[model samples]
Target: MKRKIAPFILIALSLIIAVGLSACSESGRNVEEIRIGVTGPLTGATANSGVASKQGMELAVDEWNEKGGIEVEGNKLPIKMYFEDNQGKPDQGVSTAEKLFNNEEVDFLIGDAFASSVTMAIMDLAGQYEKPILSGEPVSSAISDKITENPDKYKYFWKGNVGSDAYGDSVYQTVKMLEESGDFQPTDKTVSFVVEDTDYGRSNADEVARLLENDGWKVVAYETVEVGHTEFYPQLTKLGSLKPDLLVSVFTADSSGVALVKQINETKLKTLHTAVYYPTRPEFIENAKDSSEGLVWIPLMFEPLLRESQVDFATAIKEKWNVVATPNHALGYDTMNNALTSIAEAQSLDSEKIVEQLAKLDRDGILGRFVFDDSNHTIKAGPEYIPVPAVQIQDGKNAIIWPENISTSKYQK
Candidate 1:
């Protein structure tokens, strides 16, 4: 009996020692790898937005990691990111969100920048999982609007950038500026709106049309094209017959805008060339060339006069990734920075606690002064994402061509 008892005691002691060693080993693993989940389109038409956002997140992650990562509960852990491709589709976004929540178990989520509809679709799941999600680049006011409209439905979702109202506001200012300049008369009062039929396009176009109509401007034509509509002759011809004063083209891809530019030029539409989205960048030079000269549009960011911090960061990212960062990158890096700041201040890894810290976030970045407003979002601000420079396509490239207050007017001289 004594022998059996002794053997049992030794076995129990060994088991206890083994358990303790396992606990220590688990703790020894890098605590800094606070897994952040990233979702966006890496391929497809809107790949630019997703890829740009991913690069931005990587850039921020690299910077933070080099700086010793975040401190949480007396432990320092490096931030490790997990990514999934949503292919710029709403259904895909939902699945991506689910995978992040269930499988990856990311500490936080960011991305799906271009898919406004997709962002809205996954808002509920984010709430269910109690995981804080920083919106990557979706610009529809609807993201925070829907969340705040029904907080019970979505309490974990927040945005790090402004929305499409920037487009409408800039348009209003540009039109107003043009009117004041006396270069264009108020008689050119008819405005036409065109967009891809996606959620982002439709929502943005609706807001633009609404704002213009409220400003007492006549909407000469309001048209929606299917996502991949290649032929714009029908829409352009129909709009031409109406004789709008300015054509507001709101397509997604460079090819789409290029197609419209070529078609309109060939047809000799007499309307002023005004648009949002692509055809306002250097790429506009490749597609529309001289025809794009004097084309007016609202863009997310102007690369030339970027802040020193932004320029340095952009240069580093380009050197590392061999790709230029866009506004999407700014949003991603800001989101990561905000997350790290929250984790450091809170000193905990809990997601709900992070939400409280995020709401109080007030930090400036490459994008601009970021203060998530009552809408629980931040970005360039006034009428158009306030303070965002309204750029015009000039000499085959985007040149500051108006409201010198927001724009640097580098091309003014």
Candidate 2:
């Protein structure tokens, strides 16, 4: 049995070994780290939200790596995170998504954490090549609609947050309960919208409008602006002239919100102003502190100092990054950990198995419990799951004024 192998046979065996190693992954992950391509509005428009999300994601990855990463089969792997900014642009999101996939060779993607327009830009890339994709904060129901429309086609896509439709429920119920309880009085049952032009803004505005209309409230005006557009004087002027009893606005860019609130101060409209999304951002509070007073908004689920645990967590983040953590940060942290937990459940890097575990995931996060409905590939929303409570900005603080059981304070005129 000591016969020597031919040179040609030895060369053939070497080639087979190389091919097997190369075929181990779409991206070369046989050694070193598991790469996650992180994308967000890191530099423009909703940059604050983007930065907050990135920090939370980094913290999660750092903690995971500290634990020696999730064991896959028998070996432990560490995670390496790298970010690309989408600038809140849809085209930019699509391009960076490709760069993450074909160039950086990322095994997973957490992306466009700023707005639905940006998230949807790259959402389908996962299904295109069968890679797992997770998104944070972009809650437009259209994303869920797309997934449900072709569940098999987009089996790899998962949304970390509940749909924008939940916001409709939150806004309508908050208003109705307050009215019925005599906590709020309305001279005129009219409302209007000033939302960003993107799908996230339009979708939420539409939902809020439909619900308000069902309650016999007239929708007087609906205005849309570009993502970073700050000139809200015309809209404010119109709202002042019309004198709608309520004005509901949505924006992702903190600048837009700051501008709108400041202008609202100048216009001095008497509407019970209710905002969406932006007020949760630190920049909005800092830039428009006086104007944000009495501004009602939804889903105050992750105020940095809302709880003692949040205070400790925020302190840690501040010491590390010198930035204030917000609800957006918590959302990012939860999204990352939830995805990792599913990967651990799968016990392998196989995309199909990971998606399988994702569909079955039921876990608690800083925000609340996360349970995805495979029918829509989104987290469920309700008081039992995730509460979308409305809050009024009262003297540099958020006061929960709706849903009597959890109301921290009664509505202030």
Candidate 3:
């Protein structure tokens, strides 16, 4: 009887030790690591914008980590970023998103520069997975239209920048201001427009043209160019023949803008040249050089008009990356920081809860005060927040020329 009791006691002791070790291993698991997935055209013609955006996100994450990361529900979780190169293609964008959602299991997502096609392609996946996606710079109205049409289906998607209509109106307002100020006077009040075939370029061009016509400006020439068309002399020469007062080229690709500006100078097109978005990039100034001079553009974020906190953030970017932060960078940084803010406010890692907090967020930061319109989930463009400044390239540098309060220089013909 003693021997049987001894064997049973030994078995019971072994079981207790095994259970204790299992509990220790379970408690040791890492639950303080939050994953964020980012996608962009990291290795294509639009790489400059993509790289800038990625750098901005990295900087924001670094800053958060330096402060011991974000605290949620009593846990200070460190952020880990994972990036996927979408190459600015719709198919690739979808695939990259799948990898981030399934393989990496990221808690949040961001990115895709300038291309609305990529942004639209990923909306379904974002909705299905219930992940909140903050778009970096895809400013097409189609994004908002879809959201407005079916809010329940695409509730997780949010835009980081103002819509193309806002940009178009700002451009029109700048020209009107110039005319009123007597800085620019065209005898015929005639205009010509050129746009890339992409959704971004065409949509902005259409809006600008519509606004110009409503303002009594005649649109004599309207043309569209393929995305990578290198030579614009044929188009510019034809438009020059029309002898319009203003020649506008709405471009999304950097190389196309550079090439078009070079051709515009070579052809000696006397009409004033204006572009959107692309001209704010450093590559535009570097590649176009003197040709880029006198060109007018609408920058989503103008550095000179930024708040002190934004200025400080820009300085930090310059110091760390050895590059001047463009509007694209600001968009990237602002979107990430906004997401972080939402996470902190929610105090939970659930994506839906974060979305709820985002809808209610109305705070100022790098990109100005961000208040999302509940109907479409986009920030309204205004001087108070997300001012679309009409900037002109004077002496190969960006100078704010509109909204007198922030104008660094008067508009010059």
Best by TM-score: 2
| Candidate 2 clash figure, as a count | 0
lDDT (tens digit, per residue) of candidate 2 on 1-413: 33456776888899998888678643555556677788888887778788888898888889899899987777788888878998888899999988998778877787766678878888889888688988888899999999989988788888889999998788888888878878668887988899999989999999999898888899889999988788888888877888888888888887888999998888777777888888878777778979988888987887755545577667767877887778877888888898788888998778899999999999877777899987999999977777788888888888888767877887887
For TM-score, candidate 1 versus 2, the one ahead is 2
| Top candidate (lDDT) | 2
Better of 1 and 2 by lDDT: 2
Query: Model 2: which ten-residue window has the lowest total lDDT?
Result: 24-33
TM per model? 0.86, 0.91, 0.88
Per-residue lDDT of model 3, residues 222-254, tens digit only:
888877667888898898789899877887777
Per-model CA lDDT versus the true structure: 0.72, 0.84, 0.81
Q: Mind sharing the TM-score for model 2? A: 0.91
Tens digits of per-residue lDDT for model 1, 1-413: 99979989999999999998878644444454788887788888777667777887888888888998888887778888898998888899989888986677677887555577778787777677777887766777777678667776566777766777766676777777776777666565888877887767876777777787887889878888866566888887898788887778877666778778888888888876677767533465576886676677776453634345568777777798887656666666777787677777777778778877877777776666666665544454653333555666655556656567545444321
Error of 3 at 167 (Å): 0.5
Tell me which of candidates 2 and 3 scores higher on lDDT.
Answer: 2
